[model samples]
Target: MKYRSESILLLACAALASACGGPDGDNSEAPSPEAAEQDAAGPASNDMPDTAPAETGEASGDHEEADDDHAHEAAEGGRLESHEHGHAMLAVTLQDSMLSVSFEAPLSSLGAPEDPQNAEDEARIEAMLEDFRNDETIISLQGDAGCEIVSTSTGTRLVSGHGEMQLDYDFDCENAGGLEGVRFGGFDQYPALLSIEAVFVSDTQQMATELSAASPELKIQ
Candidate 1:
């Protein structure tokens, strides 16, 4: 079941990438599918637990329906490089007992200047990054899952004079059988961020939704 989930995730991501491209493929210039897959599966290879239950009957049907809806959403407006101000892109996947997250956004969306010119500007950037590094300040997983952060990677870059940042996280959950949802905790912390285009892939479900400071939770079973 775990291996099957990985395969499904790869296919879903491929479709997402294709759908994210512009007419001339100019808008598809984001991370490669390979890199996305690595983020999805990286922590699983290490001693990550495998406790999620397999889906059957109506659960399987619901999963398929979710995937179809997600495809439609992607075709409409979700882009690989959703670089709009006050907006960000977030991806989450739960395979076995490992949960991985990939997040990207414009630095200005977090209330930081695009280009840091002095120590004050630099300090602001660092402060925002520190907030991002705190799981409690960024997102929340169910406590019963016994999840612990396994790894994290973050970086910043500039494109066309706009500063952008990416943050990736992996968690090892001792018991993920009933893990169901994650809630974003950054809304109040970074009020400048207005929305997040999010995707969630689990052992039996593929879901996508748009989130706002008003509503910031992604539920996956």
Candidate 2:
């Protein structure tokens, strides 16, 4: 069942890539109809814990049951939202209606298409800019590292952390795609850099007011 969910996520990513035109602009290059049919037959992975009764006298069994209960409680207590798009892991925690988005990746995991010193490597990097522009997932910017616009209207913002860190990103709600809408696996060729930028809009303005008032020293412009 776990494998089934993983496969579904993979297919979701493939569909996303295909929507933009398959690799080389050939629609025929997309996954075959038979593959999609097989995927549909796959069962969904159960996220909930098992309900079997525990053994009465075994300490180990009791401990296991307790752990499972704790896990179920944790899962129910919080929202664990995650999305993989453009080869990056995006997770968010929503507390009291406020949302915090975190983007992450392992730097060592990113591979260069060729030697970084090669001209072709530079060309590949350049070509990626086009992909970035086309990617509805990433927001574009014209500034250097440290600080930049989160969005043209929402205003610029500063980033935390330092040294060999991922570039901070300000996602545009209107233009940027939602976390759930992103396609997975298509970003395998890009570098792994993680950075985050956040915006708060809600019925209660207190959260945004406090966040704005407690603004960090980092500049966004």
Candidate 3:
């Protein structure tokens, strides 16, 4: 099912697309997940300003609500919700100790057959799903957070002439406040995926950025 209510990724993408022409980065420095994890045992420092550059610039109040509504509407039945070659979106939400991450991409981007008419196709999709669930694939967290996967679900939908794949993961962290950032590891597995518009939301604020294989971490502050 589409996570319309909980996700602002579509809106983030729309805002970035309008602001930067597309969900593309500006050669900003991406966070190093390895470094963050290495310092996971250090004292928590929540005051560090967000360093991950936002592709959408700053949010203008006048356009926020309208863009959000448009995004939700687009997600319902518009072309924006469908698969786009070489592009995908990742939404990350953190509420208290519960963290939810959802990814949506084109079937072809994940190397899955457009139409799974046989057992081989089904197996291939299942294998892809398995890869997605691996902790080293989609995202990696600060080890000090003590995060563990609580559940996972995968779904597919026909959109236009192609198929779209959705993967959802839920995690419970023992030290939620210690989470410093998330590093995506799927790019190496799917090199054809050109861009991933990633959005992170927490109780205090939200941030958006574009991720690619060359730079794949989203630092939280």
Residue lDDT tens for model 1, 42-104: 645311000011110110000011133654444322222335678776677777787777676
* Candidate 2: tens digits of C-alpha lDDT, residues 34-103: 3542454444422200000110111110001113356554442211112222122332222232222332
Model 2 vs. true fold: TM = 0.25
When sorted by lDDT, best at the front, the candidate numbers are 1, 3, 2
Instruction: Name every residue pair that clashes in candidate 2.
Output: 157-220
Local distance difference test, each candidate: 0.58, 0.26, 0.56
lDDT of 3 by residue, 93-207 (tens): 7777887666778777777876677789878866775565543536566446777777666666553335667666677878878888777777877877877767777655577
Q: Candidates sorted by TM-score, descending order? A: 1, 3, 2
In terms of lDDT, the poorest run of 10 residues in model 1 is 55-64
Candidate 2 vs 3: which has more TM-score: 3
Candidate 1 local lDDT, residue 19? 41
Q: What TM-score goes with each of the models?
A: 0.63, 0.25, 0.62
